[model samples]
Target chain A: MFTGLSAFPLTPMNETGIDEVAFTRLLKRLTSAKVDSIGVLGSTGSYVYLSREERLRVTQLAVEYSEGIPIVIGISALRTREVRQLAEDAQKAGASGVLLAPVSYQQLTDIEVYSLYEMVSKSLSVPLCVYDNPTTTHFRFSDELHGKIASLQQVRSIKIPGVPNELDTAKERVKQLRTLLPRDVTIGVSGDPYGATGLNAGCDAWYSVLGGLYPDICLGITRAALAGLSESADNQSKRLEPLWQMFQKYGSLRVVATIAGMQGLTDTPNLPLPLQGLDEVARQELKNILSILKNEISLP
Target chain B: MFTGLSAFPLTPMNETGIDEVAFTRLLKRLTSAKVDSIGVLGSTGSYVYLSREERLRVTQLAVEYSEGIPIVIGISALRTREVRQLAEDAQKAGASGVLLAPVSYQQLTDIEVYSLYEMVSKSLSVPLCVYDNPTTTHFRFSDELHGKIASLQQVRSIKIPGVPNELDTAKERVKQLRTLLPRDVTIGVSGDPYGATGLNAGCDAWYSVLGGLYPDICLGITRAALAGLSESADNQSKRLEPLWQMFQKYGSLRVVATIAGMQGLTDTPNLPLPLQGLDEVARQELKNILSILKNEISLP
Candidate 1:
């Protein structure tokens, strides 16, 4: 369930709150694309920006709408108590797994991060994915720390951030991580642009942001990479270089939310407050890029 | 109101929830010490770990127990809506002011941060202090960004993390910052060890963690520095070098919570979980250091 491509969709919101209609539309797209898992409330899903009740509602909505696809809910919170509660809520709502990150205000120690996983893992009946997202969470995991966390009974996957741009170095990095984690503990790649390289580098899954909106293309890369067609996978991903550039330049959340809005899949200003959607220039640029991509590449 | 020694106390918690008795006792200590402001739910107060209801309750408690002393509530949240709500709650609860940090999960852009402060500042009736603690919030403010945020109407103070250790360099940094801020906006320094030097360098306030526990000693340093007795203030702070060392070694939150627990002001495991108190060895070292300090330094 924690393998292949885990499509992370945004929990689109309008002023009234979580846009259930738009959220289900995104989920239906991922389900139809047959992505291996649907990851809701990941950073791309804006989990930390949500209240517990809203997060739980999103969880239920994801499970209900994914059409039998595995649901991995991001259950990261600053408070351990809240993380545990969210983990339980995700399990109760029928999520296949929960993604855990050492989300903190006080920069957490390695021991503190380990303890967080240990405590949450014990309570979770479902599998827990260690969300090693330093860009957002600000907690970096050493290989030794990863080894310790992976040793926890319920921790079944580690979603790493981007790998090195160079394929050889990416492979070497993945190999090093593999030795530290158990064989059953899958290594998933995040940071959307690095998804193809990481998958070709022996990562078992792609925990992707792009996969949320354009699952078919992400899956094209994931399938080719997993089937050992490195060049084919690279070409598929390279075709979307324009989208990748936008993700890097304006942040994946804002860039993707902008695309979703332009596609009419979500309301304008879909992101939560404190996160403004892209400006007119960036939005126009994205619109141009989207039109070009639609002509240049096939998207479901 | 946003000047001098602003003490940040812990909202000491037991397993059940916020220990009101211990919280009020800590509040009383700050009140009796006559610290210039009582800063509740600041990082030292574990605001990020608290729920909105708990935070609102803490805000009211601080206002009630502060006994006419100015109350500065830390109204930081991951979401802007929540931050605005927290600001409104603090103002309605009779807090003298509110402090805000750009608490984010999706590492914020400068515009997003500025927009956050602008929106919240518009909603706030009470004065707002800009909290620039990168160690926790992971948001580094460029001087230009500070100038932009300080331009907002409700912004009355800036809580800088630390100044340089050398008095001259510290003075230069403060002077540079002062140029970017409005004349009425006070500059407060955090990072406890640098408190005396920052004040001597012309910071108007000390947003202090240690002051929350031992306000008299912190006040000793604050008073001497503001009175232009640089050497005297430095020496006063220098006397507590041992405690400062511990704070640097372990985090201030854990070390101070340990002291509070040992002093019977809070329950044994005072910090919210995932943040364990000091281990046995550190606790023993603190015990010996406390005993020695009691005999050497004049502490209240």
Candidate 2:
């Protein structure tokens, strides 16, 4: 059920509060593109920065406008009770699934990691997707631990990170992960620009950032890979080459925000403090790339 | 005014809420111990995990109970507006200074770092102390950026991290930082077990964890180093060697929470989720060390 290009919307905000009008437009664009699901309040959504009230408001609105689209709300929090609370809130607000990452100020042992998932999943009636984002969380889950989490009753999917430790090895790891876990567990991949290799490896879906911007491009890449059309998928990835280089260089944040600026979507770009978009040199580089790939990168 | 051995109390919490009575007792003990200052809501204090109301409540209690000890409240947050609001609250509540760490999920640039400190410091009447905890913040302040932030009008002190890249070179780095930075900025060292080395190298203060548990031992080491009594300082450090080894092995988190557990301070150790205390084997070792160092490490 947790498959295909799931759009992770960037929460639009201004000085006063969440830019509700801008958010509505973003949601409308996502549903209009016919993405498989909406992953509201993911890291790309700036869930960490928003207050509880504001976070819930985003979740409620995503559900209201998604119009039958499955919503996976990001419920990563610093405490177990808070995580559980966010899970219950997500369920009550009609979200289809809750995504959780073991976010900690200190490193967590495997036992603590298992108990966190167990405790939260018990409160939740909907499915939970274990988000293995070691880059941001600094907590890595071994395959042994992944199996342990997947064995939990409420867990229905695992979001394999799109970051490749070694470019060649990442696809093999995804293939290995596909065969290792329970067949019941859907294996979705995030870091969507890099989604082609994972999808070709028989992963379930692309939990995407580009799916939020222009679902057609992300969907094109994934659908091609799913149908055993590697050449077609490679061509799509080639077109996104410039943006992928930026993600590799300085995270995907500035590139996405800069693209939003080029579009008329946001005035002040709803990024968290101290995380500005591309500097002048990088901005110019981006412009040069976009001028060549303009039709491929632009929204309707 | 931010000099000498400063104590950062662990915020004791239970299922109900913040253990206010225990927190007050913790404050009174610090005041009685005559440590330099009180830093509330630090990493040990679990500031990132806490709600705004709970954080403010702890701040109020720290100020009220602390006889004349200067209070430095940690105001690290994901958003600038939240940081500004906290700084204003700290000033209104009579805190001596506010501590800001440019904590973000998004990696920040030098311009963003300077602007974060600038935005918050401008709203405050009190002095601001910049906390450099890269392990938790994942944001390193290059010496160049440090110089820029220190030049801000309201930033008077910098909590220089004492975590060594190499044990032998840690003190040398402190010396280099002291030389490169402005003479007026008070360089306070954290990672307190290593305080003797940093203090001996001319750091002005010790931002301490053990001081919250046993101030005399930490203060003794810092004062000896300050007085140029190397042998006396070395003895104090050698007495606390077992605890330091544990901090090096794991983080100082489990050991500190374990000591608080042994003291019967609270039913729960008050650590944030997935950051539990030491395992059984480690606890036995900690007790053995305490038994040997009882005279030196004991509180009044």
Candidate 3:
């Protein structure tokens, strides 16, 4: 069911609780930009850092104001039962689907990984998007495991990270996934820089990072690529190259949190102590990049 | 200062909440068996899975019932600020020291890694033990970084993981740490099989795993090694060779959870869903191991 650009934003927070006003405004911005769907409490959303109650509160706010932009709740946990419980909670909260990345501190076996998706997906009526994020979970899904997991009853989609491997191109990886997976299973690629290329190469969706702050820009690129406008998509991607470089260098978490603060969305943008956003030099660089991109890209 | 054997157990849980009765009983069992110290809310304790409130409750129970034994609280988080807050919370809760691993999903630079410890240690009044569990954190520490962290003002100890790496033995790593670090700082090693060897090589402590369920065995090995009784220490370690092999094959988290369940400490062991504790066959193998060890090593 998941297709096109899914915008994932940083969870704006203040000292007291979530900055509801800023968050609502951000949601409104996404709806205005007409992104395909919105992924809440994702890695970009800092789900791990928030407490259970706080995370639920976030889920509540997201569901309440997503308008028609489908809200796919990220139900990630170290435990399988917790992931299922979270999935149930998301369904009750009116989530369109659930996203899960089986996170573990221990080295999990292939069977362990398969069993996890099997249990959670079977229990959910809504679509479950298997998040293949090796950076966060350290659990890589082989093509064989992907095939086994896709057979699970409610696994409707697969969200893979942007593969920057020198040998295999993202396009080729998408092609392999398309061939390996069932036809109904939606294939989406995340990681801002690699997204445009993946979408152009036949991925069904782009689970976007830049879409969080700049939904219009991401939507522009994603739409262009999807409509077979490769040149336009490449140009749009080139326009955001500076931000992509920052994401590659410092990660989307750091860069996104910095951008949220720079945009004056939330005061306590950086959560989980001691991790301050972009340093002074990087802040200036981000500022210049944002200004140039703003000038280059206009409303659709 | 923490020395000798420190028992670390899994935090028992049921549908209602934390299984406090079972937890208390496990604590009592360790205390009666005479562990030198008790590390509660540690990795083996499932620290990351528990909520902030739950973690504090567990910490409170640990400190209150510890009687005379010191409690070292695990304060690992992705953010430096949360780690600092947890350290402050632990101090307030009457903990002896805090153990931190600087866990991050994103890869951290040497500067970022050292900065995390530097900032947190500066903010903490109590001793901070540097936990080097690269397997869990996915962040390996260089000897140079370890030397710098050991020089932190409040850092009183180093806790290295049981490295089976051919390039770096735990003993050699301990020797290097002891030389590079200040003379007063204590060096401890975890990963049960390596404890006796690390202790014999000059580590002042052994932050153990098996000690949680069977403190007497670990205590015997640690004490013998501390007292320069290599023959006795080797004998004690050799006694645990089977369990050590299981730990290597599957990981301590799986093996320990099974041991706790097999010992009837908790019926529902913490296996982190999708991954159940050692299956029935493995459980039977474990029961055989425990029954044999119980026969071989009598209670003090």
Best by lDDT: 1
Clashing pairs in 2: none
Candidate 2 chain A worst ten-residue window by lDDT: A162-171
Stronger candidate by DockQ (1 vs 3):
1
- Give the CAPRI rating of model 1: medium
Model 3, which residues run further than 4 Å from truth? Answer: A14-16, A163-172, A265-271, A284-300, B77-89, B108-125, B151-153, B163-172, B268-275, B284-300
Q: In model 3, how large is the Cα lDDT of residue B214?
A: 78
Task: Judging by TM-score, tell me the better candidate of 1 and 3.
Answer: 1
Q: Give the candidate order by descending TM-score.
A: 1, 2, 3
Report the lDDT tens digits of candidate 2 across residue range B1-300: 678888888888864578887778777778887888888888888788888888888888888887988999988887887888787777778899888888767677788889888877777788888999887887888887888888888888899887463434866777777666677788988886668877776678888887776777787887898898866876778778888898877677667777887887655566766567788898888888788777655642
- Which of the numbered candidates is closest to the native, going by highest DockQ? 1
Tell me candidate 3's fraction of native contacts, as a decimal between 0 and 1. 0.58
Kindly report which residue stretches of model 2 are placed more than 4 angstroms away from their true locations once superposed.
A163-168, A295-300, B163-171, B295-300
**Which candidate's TM-score is highest?**
1
Q: lDDT at B299 for candidate 1?
A: 51
Greater-lDDT candidate between 1 and 2: 1
True contacts kept of 2: 0.68
lDDT of 1 at B199: 98
What's the TM-score of every candidate structure?
0.97, 0.96, 0.88
